[model samples]
Target: FDQNPLAQMVVVGIKAGIGERNSNLSGNPQDVLKSISDRHKLEPTGEPSLQNSIKMVRDSME
Candidate 1:
């Protein structure tokens, strides 16, 4: 995404604590990087719910 100016990206952080949040769709590489860096502050908990995460992603895309 950083290499492609036309590409847009969204980031989702799923924690084992069953928490979820996402960076809204963004085309800026810097914004995407910042979103990831900011989300890294949260320590992961138990196992991530792939099902929940996928649902969240699908909802966000809509």
Candidate 2:
């Protein structure tokens, strides 16, 4: 298995649905969202749907 896992992760993350409003979650929002999405076993969808929004807020505590 000589696949580039990290590169794949980045690709999946960028396609996760990030937008302007979501473009400010952090100074490095793009990167942060990626981390968040990965943690939830998601594809880095930065849209933060009803479900992910709730999860993101909850995860912030930890």
Candidate 3:
């Protein structure tokens, strides 16, 4: 972000043991930070699935 004017970010949260897209691709630092904050508040459950999470992120990006 702030350091990279050309950079954009997307925030994804692991939910139900899988990656869930929480925010759209954005260049705004505030939007990215808020997405992180909101996702962090959730109580985590289930065993994390890295493969599934990666797949979700990849699918969303595509």
Candidate 4:
């Protein structure tokens, strides 16, 4: 996992979701998603908006 960027990203996304769930912060979901994306060095590539990507990530956690 340490050697693979993709794996690292998956872990980061999961952490982001868990962090958000446990925190008292409140704002648009997209803002949280953007923060996670920035942390993981992800950028929207036109296929899926950041919001959709966020939804997908959270859904996969379920």
The global C-alpha lDDT for each of the candidates, from Candidate 1 onward, is 0.78, 0.41, 0.82, 0.44
lDDT tens digits, residue span 1-62, model 4: 34443442342233322322222233445454566556666432334244545676577568
For candidate 2, the clash count comes to 0
| Order of candidate numbers by lDDT, starting with the best | 3, 1, 4, 2
- What TM-score goes with each of the models? 0.75, 0.24, 0.81, 0.28
Error (Å) of candidate 4 at residue 62 is: 0.8
1 or 4, greater by TM-score: 1
Residues 20-60 of candidate 1: C-alpha lDDT, one tens digit per residue: 76687889988879999988887777887878887887887
Per-structure clash totals for the candidates = 0, 0, 0, 0
lDDT-wise, the better of 2 and 4 is: 4
Q: After superposition, how far is residue 41 of candidate 1 from its true place, in Å?
A: 2.2
**Candidate 3 residue-wise lDDT, 1-62, digit = tens:** 69988998887666567777788899899998998898788888877777887898788767
* Stretches > 4 Å off in candidate 1: 17-19
RMSD of each: 1.9, 12.7, 1.4, 14.0
Q: After superposition, how far is residue 51 of candidate 4 from its true place, in Å?
A: 0.2
Residue lDDT tens for model 2, 1-62: 12433331121123243222222233444575666665567345435345544455456448
Tell me model 4's lDDT, rounded to 2 decimals: 0.44
Assess candidate 1 and give its TM-score to the true structure. Answer: 0.75
Q: Between which residue pairs do clashes occur in model 2?
A: none
